[model samples]
Target: MGRRILVVDDEPDILELTRLSLVREGYEVETAATGEEALACLRRSRPDLVVLDLMLPDRPGTDVCRVIRTTPELSDVAVIMLTARGDEVDRIVGFELGADDYVTKPFSPRELGLRVKAILRRGVEEKTESEHLKQHGLELDLSRHRCLHRDEEIALTAKEFLLLAALMRRPGRVLTRERLLEEVWGEGIAVTLRTVDTHMKRLREKLGPAGDLIDTVRGVGYRFRE
Candidate 1:
């Protein structure tokens, strides 16, 4: 079967539009109208990605996102948040809550489809690369999508793992925020430079002392110490 996607949105029109768009992209699409239904679908089906709306009739979508992130069985699932609010702060909030991407309302179904494709493509690319990357006691098992610091596992969101992988793959090279954005978020996704910073901060915290290995070059970008 093709990659599974669970789309949660209360708007009947949007829900169907998103499903149709992704289906056209060759994805297996599932739809849910509320947060609780979304959660139930999550447990029942465990789709590879979820297109979630920030506002839900039953509970805030952020709350559902938190559940997915905290639950061990479902934490690694990718999330893209949908919202009517287009403010940067709202976008940042979604990112902070572990969303892989954010789409504002009145969005084109095609654009949303592209965003979903990029996120899912990222996972496929990771599997095709070198399986293990180790630097300064920080290690990434690319095949497994696992990060380890000195043999201790560090749970990271999907984007966090990809960001770390990008840095480690080019140790000692100063990757501009723009470059990192391209490599991690990929093309066709609308994300700002601050999005990179937010993920980096969270990545560093998860890495603990090993986080220091990622050096920020003032005004330029970031580099992983050789």
Candidate 2:
């Protein structure tokens, strides 16, 4: 089967439009008009990715995302939040809840489709031959999508994992913000440089003491310590 996607939104027009666009892109798409229905569908069979809306009639999308993140069966499912509100706080909250990406309302379906493709691609891209990376007291299992610090498991969102993987793959090389954005986020997606910083901050915090491995290069960008 093709890549599966579940789009959750209360707006029928938005759901239909998104489904149509994604179907045209060859994704097998399913949609839910309420958070309840979304969860029901998720329980039946998990999709590869979920396009979740922040506002829902049955329950807040954040609630659904939280459930997905906490549920071991659904934790690895990639989520892209759809919101009418573009506030930084909301975005931060969404990310904190483990959203893989965010798209604001009045968005172009084409661009959103591109973002979906980019995110899905990033999930499967193999950056290294070895399945495990051990450096600076941090261990990343590429195949398992798991990270360990001081032998304790560190939970990371999909984007956080990708961002850390990118940096570790090129240790000692300074990766500019623009470069990191391109490598991790892909092209044609609308996202600010600050978004990279935000994820990096969270990524560092999750890495605990090993956080120092990712060094800030002042104005240029960040680099994994050599």
List lDDT for all candidates, in order. Answer: 0.88, 0.88
lDDT per residue as tens, model 2, 1-226: 2299999999999999999999999999999999999999988879989999989998999889999999999887888888786785455445578788888888999989989999888776632335678887788898889999888999999999999999988889999989988988897778998999999999989888889899999989999988
Stretches of model 2 off by over 4 angstroms after superposition: 89-95, 126-130, 133-226
User: What is the Cα-based lDDT of residue 209 in candidate 1?
Assistant: 91
Q: How far is 16's C-alpha from truth in model 2 (Å)? A: 0.5
**By TM-score, how accurate is candidate 2?**
0.56
TM-score per candidate, chains pooled: 0.56, 0.56
Off by over 4 Å in 1: 88-95, 127-130, 133-226
**How much is 39 displaced in model 1, in angstroms?**
0.6
Q: How does model 1 score by TM-score?
A: 0.56
* Candidate 2 Cα deviation (angstroms), residue 127: 9.6
